[model samples]
Target: MKKHIIPTIAFALFTTSAYGQSMQVGFSNVTTVVPGGDIKICKARYGTGYVTSPHKNGAKIHKSSDKGHFIHITKSNVTLHHDVYVMANEYNMSYPGDKGEITAKAYVYATALDRKSGFSGVFSDGQCKGQLTISAK
Candidate 1:
């Protein structure tokens, strides 16, 4: 128990410190899934800086929205891998007869499955906060 506790504390401290760097990550505009050009963040569990959710869309007038995979567990699904953020829109864009203006977004595809990515950002984009994508060159 002593050994485990020591390591856990160290690990927590390390992650907390790493968030200060402010790394930038990018994700391809969700080729696979993105309801209403967004992803709903129904649930999020991570460190103080990170956040995730499953329900990315829906409303009272609409009653309900389509459901996506429940990514509560890390090993259960690959989609639930990196941190996930679902999204949607409240207002519609004014256009000349059916102009395609997709302001609504479902799920902000944040990589690394960490808390800092969703909880913090350079600016205010809400769920689509934090690094866009990061990878080895």
Candidate 2:
């Protein structure tokens, strides 16, 4: 009986550790326009990895019933903010014909469902640059 109980407890602990807890994060209020004029907001981490679908501007927030998908904004775009524009232009001016690409970082307010187990703050992405990292936490 003792041997069987010990094995059962050990199995339970192992299983629990093997499958980490799921996390959900949501963001709102902020909006951004893509290069082609499409608007986007960000939502990160519903389950494990990133998930994306083409959505219209001002569309309702999407929630996945499935357990392993999350949503995030993609396709970095240039911003029209005056300060950012000036800075980017200055950087570009260093190149011939002032034709260098501009890169800017944008931040979004975020909240995570996990308490004391993960992070909750402003998430950032580099616009007009390469791939962005959206972690599941």
Candidate 3:
């Protein structure tokens, strides 16, 4: 009885450890536009984003459902406020030479994410330049 109990306990512990908790994140009411008049959606379309040093207090902003995603700050290469934290995810844009609207792009899972002091993400031109306007849906 003792031997059987120990084996079962050990197996349960091992299984629980192996299948650890996974992170959950969501980005709704998302909208972004480019200087040329294009939209940028940072949902599952591209992938997860990065939350820079300003937009966070520690390594990451775990509770994002409360504070909205700061898409503008992540694109301007400048701090939104004194300390603008954010998610460093990917997005898509429609560059029709200032004659386009925002639309859902695609989704992807990235390997890692990075934090920065300025804008660095998906854009219409892919250069991180131009007006990458972003707001809640």
Candidate 4:
């Protein structure tokens, strides 16, 4: 009983200290522009991750708009390794009359100690291209 109690307390302390240092990060107001074209905007951008199993790490850039037409990016899967998280998604473009698939990748990093973070990435669909930028605190 004594041996089990000592190990249990040690394990609890280790896990608590590990998770206590992590920050819940959020980013917002995604904006992008492609050269020779108008600017694009997205409603919200956010990312989250966990060290525990059965919980997934993911990020999203959503409700993008161009000239009053709306495009919703989704909750795409992101890979979290240490301090960085990354994702790449390819899907059919669903604009009213447009026809193509867009490919995008996001790379972001956050310190376990800080709440402020930012990221910039790029995406393209045939002739259409843009960069995504977001900052969170």
What local distance difference test score does each model get?
0.25, 0.26, 0.26, 0.32
Compared with the true structure, what per-residue lDDT tens digits does model 2 show for residues 48-108? 2232322233322212213233222222122223222100111110111223322333344
**TM-score to true structure, per model:** 0.19, 0.24, 0.18, 0.33
Choose 1 or 2, whichever is better by TM-score.
2
Give the alpha carbon lDDT tens digit for every residue of 1-137 in model 4. 11112232242233231112222223343334444543332221221211221112222222332222223333233333454434444433334333423433333322222223333455544434435443321
What TM-score would you give candidate 2 relative to the actual structure?
0.24
Q: Residue-wise lDDT of candidate 3 within 31-63, one digit each (tens)?
A: 444444333423323233322122243312121
lDDT tens digits, residues 4-51, model 1? 122322422433421122222233222212334334321221111222
RMSD of each: 15.2, 18.7, 17.1, 12.9
lDDT of 3: 0.26
lDDT of 3 at 94: 32
Question: Could you tell me the TM-score of candidate 1?
Answer: 0.19
Clashes of 3: 25
Clashes of each: 36, 0, 25, 0
Q: After superposition, how far is residue 127 of candidate 1 from its true place, in Å?
A: 10
Off by over 4 Å in 3: 1-20, 33-37, 40-137
Error of 2 at 56 (Å): 29
Would you list the rank order by TM-score, best first?
4, 2, 1, 3
